[model samples]
Target: MQQTYQTLNALTNFYGAMTAAESARRGYIFLGSSQDLQRYYNAKADMRSQLQILQKQIHPDESQEKRLVSLNLLVNQRLSLLEQSIELYQKDKTALLIQNNITVSSVQIREKILKVIADIKAEEQTYLQDSLEQSKQSIYFRVFIEIFTTFLILIIILGLCMILENQWIKRERIRDLESSLAQEKKIGDLKIQLFSMISHEFRTPLSIILLSAQLLKESLENLVDRQQLKNIFRIQSSAKIMNHILTDILILTRAEAGQLDFKLQVINLENFCLNLVEDLQLFATTANMLRFQKIGSIFKANIDERLLYSILSNLLLNAIKYSNNETEIYLILKSEADMITFQVIDQGIGIPLAEQHKIYEPFYRCQNVENIAGTGLGLAVVKKCIELHQGEIIVESKVGTGTTFTIMIPQENT
Candidate 1:
């Protein structure tokens, strides 16, 4: 009876250690902390040693020994599987660092790990229940033999009750944690939906304001004095800037919702780019500062005009905005065998190398550009547009030197 109690105590301690290790593993996986991982490994090794010692010390009947061996093997198998998953997670994290690629596969793998953890917890509960049942049977048999020992029986009962209560509290904590995680996920999803709806709803009013500004500019052109004309120009520019912001928001909303429609039509590449530059030049403070150059023989290609316009206009506007009036902005177009590459170069306050990676994220702006007027969604919108056209955009920049945006898109053969 004493040996049985000793074995049960060791098993309980081993289970506690396993639970601690699992928690540490979860922390390492989600929070990416090496310290937690180290703790987990330490606990795992301790658990293995403790279980080995207990297995050798507790030599019960044939049936009970078989049960103990089976339980030990089950735990070892689960721990080994968990170790593999942790190793895989480490590899995935390393790959993410090296490649700078955020793929859905990582999320899927995390879900798999979470599921495995859940399974392990369930198995632990089952094992604990089986052990408890066995212990109860042994205790009841001992109580039947020693019916006169009422105080000892009461103490044993109280201990069993305390252990069951501890198990209940632990299970409740796990349930609460799962609930909180689910709730957070739901909130995140709702935020995206809300952002999309708000952005979509804003376009109508922005379009009206832009139209009114254009009409006011046309009506005052001949009647107003030079100063008034300048005021009107400022109003028009402000309205245009607001309109661009709204367009970016709308495009981002559409992109997020996977609703961006592409209407492909043949367009004259050189003339298309020239007209775009001409349109943007109105917003420029200096005359002849924005230049367009075509490197190769440009031909008509099937392209979505609106998306292409959005891409070029945003890049050109950014170049103009970030640079001084005296600084020249270059828009270079190169037509390849099956692709068209566009480059927008500007002698602007360039982005830092560390910040360049985050520029494409929605509403992310460079620290230097905070004082400058921008919605910070221009590059994000440009990236989305390029992605829709199966294109790639790369940036080259040095602080106080200059910045260049290179975009390459496949020419649709139609």
Candidate 2:
């Protein structure tokens, strides 16, 4: 019976030693896994730092402080639980060592060790599950945050693109509107010019005709034969002026409508100019000089003779009308290396300095020459005819001194 009691005591001592060793093994496992906990804490700290950075990146308008407080509390609770488990295992190890003695078997000790190992593994699995759940939560939150940030950025980019597109469309519409307005203004200006031309140009010629007819019937009929004949001739001359002015108007209208057909032919330029000078002599009775200086060479080129005649006639008429009585007008013809230049020089009430630039504009007559008999379309027609021939015309004038109109015409090679 003593032997039997000794065996039972030995069995008890072996079980106690096994329990203490198992407790020590569990303590070592807890200590070993403490590094894992520390690592988890470091990961959480890194996550918190990243979360803080992400929060900073977010606009202050969105909610932020609540999420930060909740995450800090959860991490603190996990650390508290880990420290408590470590303390419980340490106390159990001290209790097991204090309770045993005297001849224990290795097999019994191993059985107790196996039971502790199974319990430790169970605790480890629980800890792993909790960590996995936390990781999944962290990952899901991170993914959600990234997607939200990307969506906001895309929306901002789209807004800017839309704004830029709207600005571009607005500018294009403004440009189109401005273009339309400019076209309407040009049409309105043309209509005004036409009205002025009809009133002034048409009225002057009609007045002359009516006045002459009335004078012949009422005042000149009682005169003697020679006086009566002179009066008739005066009436005829007035009619002729009216007819000439009408003809110029018709020609210019046809040209503007693209209905004027030119009969292009080569002509003797010098002879043509001479004949024009002789024809203009009759109208130069108002102390206007029409002098044609001869060019040294009899140079000729292909041109529409009728068009050239009109150009020269209009230029000389303008000179005569603008010049003061008895002012000597000059007609100069110069031949350069590649061009022929005709110049009309007059010492009249010259164009004003400010208006010289605008003189070429259609229907815009010089303010100084308003008293003169003009339709204001003469220079415009001259310019158009010259442009048709692919030539250039320039005018230089000084107020109260003189004016010079130079026509530079291109010569086609034969």
RMSD each, Å:
31.8, 49.2
lDDT per residue, candidate 1, 12-95, as tens digits? 677668777876876786778898899899889978876776676564446446555665665666676567557767878554
Question: What is candidate 1's TM-score against the reference?
Answer: 0.51
The TM-score of predicted model 2 comes to: 0.44
Alpha-carbon shift of residue 153 in model 2 (angstroms): 80
Per-residue C-alpha lDDT of model 2 across residues 1-414, encoded as one tens digit per residue: 222223223333434443343344343534545544445445444544543443343222222334334434543443344344445455673443322321123334344444533443333334334444445455445534543554465467458657755765565565677776665455445434553454465555455554434433333243346545554555554554544555565556656655566776767678678778887775574533788885657446677787777777778877777777878777887765467788888887788888877865667798888667777777777876787778898888887788898898887666
- lDDT for 48 (candidate 1): 84
- Candidate 1 ranges beyond 4 A from true positions: 1-219, 412-414
TM-score of each: 0.51, 0.44
Candidate 2: worst 10 consecutive residues by lDDT?
97-106
The superposed Cα distance between candidate 2 and the true structure at residue 203, in angstroms, equals 16
Residue 410 displacement in candidate 2 (angstroms): 0.4
